[model samples]
Target: MTQSMFRRHFRTPGTESSSAVRPLRASAAAGPATETIASYLNKRLAEIGVRYVMAIPGDYISDWVETLDDPEVNAGLVRVHPNNEMCATYAADGFGRAGGGKTVGCVSTTYGVGALNAVQAVAGAYVEHVPLVLVNGSPSVAQFNSQRDQGVLWHHMFDGSLTDLRIYEQITRMAIRIDNPALAPDLIDAALTACITDSRPVYIEIANTLEGYAVAPVSGRAKLKKSPIPQNTLSLDEAMSMVLPILVDSKRLVVLGGVEVARFGIQDRFRQMLKVLKAPFLSSLLGKSILSEYDTPYFSGTYNGRNSQQNVQDLVNAADVILSLGVQETDFNFSGVASADFNPLQPPGLPLQGSIEVRMGAARINAGLTLQDQGELYWGDIQLEAFVGLLQEVVCEPSGPAMQSLVSQFPALAPVQAALQAANGQLPNAPFPGLSGDIWSIPKLTPEQYRDQITWDSFKSLLHHNYLTSFGNDENQDAPVLLADTGLTFYNLNNVKVPQNGFIAQLAWGAIGYSPAASYGVKLAQMALGSRRRVISVSGDGAFSQSSNAIGTIAALGLDNVVFVMANGVFAIEQFLINAQAFNPQSKTAFAPFTRVPETSLWQWVKLAEGFGGVGYEVTTNAELADVLEKIKAGPPQPAQPNGPCSGSPAPGCCTFAPDATPDVRPSTFTLVAVRNVCNDLPSNTRWKLG
Candidate 1:
C-alpha cells in the first residue's frame, strides 16, 4: 500500500522528459514584443496575487530581482539571511509552512549547481507533501547549442545544466525547461499550477539570460487556485459501528495525532473526540502541542527528550483498540509501522491481540482497523475541520471506568520534587552573580522529584502532565505556546493542546529553521489579533543558528516572549540513525560538521538582542532562569523597539536594521550597555561593555 502511494503519485523527472507538453501561456505567435520579460513576470505574479518573493539572487537573477525592486512592481522580497543554498531553501520552506498553502517562492540562479544544492530541502518538501514553487535561472536559450564561448566554459555550468535531466525528475512533480522565451509565461503558469494543484514542489527552469526577456504579448493567466481539498466521507453506520465498539469495550484506549491533524484543521475536532471518550492521547513531534504542551492526564508523553515510545506502545498494545487520526506511517513516526501491535517488539513467537484503527487520508493499508472512506481522499484544506465534525457526531463513554484510573496506578511521578528534596530543599544559587535559576530547565530529574512538584491548579504550577495540557482557553488563545523546529524536537512530540491563542507549531514540511521563521509569524499573528499572550520557541541551538538573523527580527519587533534554546551540541535525531540500520551494530552516527560555537560568547546573543532594541541575558541553571522570568513578567515593556524593513520597523515598513551592524563584530565583542531592566528596550543612552 505504501509503495503504491509512493510510486503512482510520485512523478520522476524521467517521466516528465518523455512526456510531450503544450504551452498554456501567452506569447506573440510572430509579432513584435511589447513588455519586458521581467515586467511580464511581475504582472503575472501580481495577477496570481503573489506579493512575496524570497531569494538571494545570483548574477543570473539580478536583472529580474532588480526589476522587482522597482516601485512599479511593488512585490515584497524577504532577503533571507542565510549563507548557503541549504538554509536559503529552508527559509523558503518555512515561508511556505506559514503561508498556508500559498506559493512561497524559492528563487536561485540557473545551472544544476544551485538547484542541486537545494535538492534535499526540495526532497523534504516533496516527501512531506508541502507545496513550494522553485524558480531557477539558467543560461540563455540561445546558448543551448553553442558549446564553445561562454556557458561551455562557465564555472558552475554543466553540459546539460539547463535541463538537469538526471535529478530534478526524481523529487519534483514536474520539471520543465523554458527554452522558448515566448512559451515561458505559459510554462511558468503550468509549473505553478502543478505546484499548487498537486501540493508539491515543481521545478521551472528559465535560462539565466531569458528571465524577463522581452515578450511581445504577455499571457493573461490566473494563478492556479488549488481545488477545494476533497473530503473523504465515511459511512456513518460503518464508522460508528467500528469505532463505537472500541469506545464501549476498551478499558485503556488512546488517541494519536500528527501533522495532518493540523493540516486538515481538525485540532478542535480532535479535542472533542478525546473529551468525549476521555482516552489518554499522545502526539508525535510532527503533532506536538497541537492542543497544549503543559500537563494533562491524556498526554502520554511518548515523544520528546525522554523516549516515551515504549510507554505509548504499552498503552496501544494493552488497549482493545487504538484510534489514530491523521497519522502517517512515515519512518520518523510509528517507527514505520501501520499499527503498533504489528511492530517488532511483541515476543517473536507470541500472537498480538488488539487492533489499531486509523482514520486518515487517501493512503491505504491492511491494518487492524482501516477506514477507507474516500473523504480522506479529498484534498481540500478544510477536511480537518470536516473530520472534526464527523468525529463529534459519533461518540461514546469509556467502556468502563475512564482510562485515568489506569494511569492513577502510577501515581504522580515527581523527578524535580525528589531532586529538590534530596538536595536539602535548596535550589542552586544563580550561575551569574545577579540572577535566579530557571525552574523550566529541569526536564529530567529523578522520578520521585518529578512527583513532588505535582499540584492541582493549572495556573500555579507545572501539572503532573504531558504535552496535552496546553489545550483549551477557547475564548482567549487558540493554540499552544511551545513551538519546536524540525530538529530533535519534531520527532517526539504529539497531542498538542494549545489555548485559543496558543500556537503549537507550523513546521508541517519537516524542515529545520522552521521554528525560527515561524516564531516571527506567530508573534506577528498574535499581535495582529490583539492578543498579548507570551510566545515561546523551544528550539535546539542548532536550529537557532539556521535562522539566527531572526533574533534581530524578534528584538526589532520587541515581541514579549522568550526563546529557550537547548544547548546540546549534537543533532539529537542523528543518534536514532542506528535504528535505521538495525543490522549494523557499529553504524557510525554523528551530526556532520561537528563544529562547536564557544559557549562563552552568548553575550553576543544579548548584543543581538540589544542591537535589535531588545534585552538579552544568559543563564546556566534553573534557579536563575525562574528569577529572570519573574523579573521579566514584572518589568515594564521596553521603549518602542526600533523597526527594520519588512518587520517591526517603528514606521510601517522600514528596512533599516541589519542583523550584524557595520563591523558585524559588535555583538561578539560588545557587552551590555546597561542591565537597567531585563525587559527594557535599549533606551537611546544605554551603554555596554565587551566580552
Candidate 2:
C-alpha cells in the first residue's frame, strides 16, 4: 500500500519536521495547483495507518470510485473487492479484533439496502464492541431535496430526500452527514474518533458531490482527543453511597456489563474482588472471556452457560441486589424478549392470531436497565469507574474461604461428565496407541494446551486483544493472535479456557463470517503493532463457508496461524428454532436446513485452503490429529504463498479414521463420587452454594 491512500499523522504546531509543508509560491508553481476531493480523502487516509478498505462500488460513492480507481491518487493506499457490504464490514471488523486499534473504514452507497445489509455485521461490532467506522457516500448534496424532481429516477436513488435515517437512529454511537465539502475532513476525523472512543461503531455520510470539490489545505487542527472514561465523571461520594452498600450487604452479588473490565484495565482488580467476595460472576455476551487470566468457577453465571441457563436465570431473578458495572440493557442482551408469539385464544394446531409463543427461560434478565441516583428504573450513565475510588478503599480478605468453598460445592458435573463418557462412543474399539483412557480426557485439555502442543504463541483476548502479551523486554514481539467465531467455541470459552491474549468474536454486531476476513486484519494489526505474534483464526463450518473467498486472501498473505475450521456443518444457535417448532405444534417457523450437509464435501474446504497456499487438513477423528496440529504449530513463520499447496493438506490414507473412531467410556461410580466430594468441599460463601 502507498502512503497517499491513508491520512498522515499530524504534528503539532512548532513541531513541524516535514519540508513538504513549505508554503507554495503562486509564481513558482505553474498555474493554480488543484486537487480533487478523492485525492484529498485518499491522501488523509494514507496519513493514518489505514491502507486498505474493503468495499464494493455503489452509485452514491462514485466519487471515491473515481478517486480510488485513479492510478495517480490511490497508488498503494486503496484496494477494492467485488463483494457485499457484509463481507466488507466483516473484513474490517476482523481487522479491528486483530488489534489494529484504528478503525478500518468501510464505505457503501446510501439507502435502506446498503445500511441494512451492513447492519447485521455492524450490529455485531456494536454488541461485541468492536471498533468499526462506516462511511456512506450520500446522494449529491445538491440533489438531496431536488433528486426526486430531476427525473433522474434510478434504482439506487430514492423518491424521498436522501438521509441515512434508518441507521442514523438505530446502531451507531455517533453519526454525521456532510452537505458541505469544507467540513469533510472534520467529519472524517470525528468519525474515526467516535469509533475508538468507547470502542464502539460510528457512521459518517459523505455526499458524492463532495469528492471533487476543492478546499483549502487541511490545517491539521481538526483531530479528536480520547473520550475520558465515563466512570471518571461520577461524583466520588455518590458512587460510594451507591455501590459500597451493595457490596457490603449482598451475599449473592456479581458484576455484569463486563465493559468496565477493559475501561479500567482491571481484570486483575476484578479477580481480586471475586476472590474477596466469593461471589459467582456472570458477564453479558460482550463480557465473555473478560477475565481470561483467572479460571474461577465463579466465571460462568447460570444464564450464560449452556447447562446452567435456568439456574442462572433463577439466580439473577432471585438476587436481593444485582450490582452492575458498565452494563447497559440492550434488546439483544436482554432475556425478557419473548421467543414465541402465540395467540392465547387459539387451540393447539389452529391458525393463531399472532406467532405461537414459547419462551426460553434464558431470556429474562434485562442487562440494559440502570440504577439511577434517584432510584428510578431507567437506562443510561452506566460506567464502572464511578465507583473505583470507593472500590479501591474497600480492603478485601485476600484468602477468603469462599473461593475454595465454591470450587468444592458446585456439582453439576453430570453434563460435562456425560460428555466425557460420550467421547468413547466417538472412538473405534481398536488397539489405538494413544487412545487409552476415559473419553472425557480427549477434550479435557485447556486452550493453553492446544497452544503449547503447537509451537505458535499468539493469543488475542476478546476484550483487549493484548492481555496475554509479554513484558518490556519482549514487548516488541508480534501479537500471538487467534480469532474465534461465534458458536459453542466462543460461548463455551469460559469452560474450556485459553491464554489471555486470544481474541474471540466480541463484535457487538453479532454478524457471522466475521472471523475469516478479520483474521487478515489481525495479521495486519500485529504487523502494525511491531509484534511477531502468529495469527490464527478458528471458524465453524457455516461461518467459514459464508465468506469462504477470504481463504484466497489468507493464502495471499500467508499469515502465521493456521485457520482451523471446526466443521459441525450446522448453525447450532438455530436449534432453538427447531426446539420451538417441535414443542409448539401451532408454531409456523420452519427448522433451518441442518441434515443435508454432504459430510464428504467438507474435504473441499481443505482443498480450497490449500489452493490458497494455506496449510489445510481434515481431522475427522482424534487419531494423529493432535500430531498434525503440533506440526503446523512448529512450522517456520512465513506469509502464506497464494498458489502454494498447503503442506498440511490432508492426503489419501493419511486422512482416514475408523467409522467408530471415538468410543464412549462411561465414568465409574468412583469418579462421580470423587467429583461430588470435590464439590461438597467448597466453602459456604461460594456463590454456587446456598445456605
Look at candidate 2 and tell me the lDDT of residue 529: 51
- Root-mean-square deviation (CA) per prediction: 16.0, 17.1
C-alpha lDDT score of every prediction, in listed order: 0.46, 0.45
lDDT of 1 by residue, 1-691 (tens): 3553222222211223342332222233323444555556665554433444545556545555555545543233323333456655554554444333433445454456677778877887676555566666665544444444443544356774444635777898888876666786677667666666555677776665454345544444444565534554433223333343334444555566665554434565677666555566666545554555443335554332123344444555555454556654444444333233554555421112343434333322123333444222222232444444544443332122322232233233123223323434222110111112221222333434432321111111221133223433445453334466664444323323454324444343556555665554455445434555555565555566666665554553445555555444434334333232311235453334443324323535556556655566654433344345555445424554334354332465544544332212111111111111111011111111000
Give one digit per residue, the lDDT tens place, for model 2 in 309-395: 444555555454454554433322442232245666744221111111111100111222224434332223333443432343332
Model 1 residue 679 lDDT score: 15
lDDT of 2 at 466: 21
lDDT of 2: 0.45
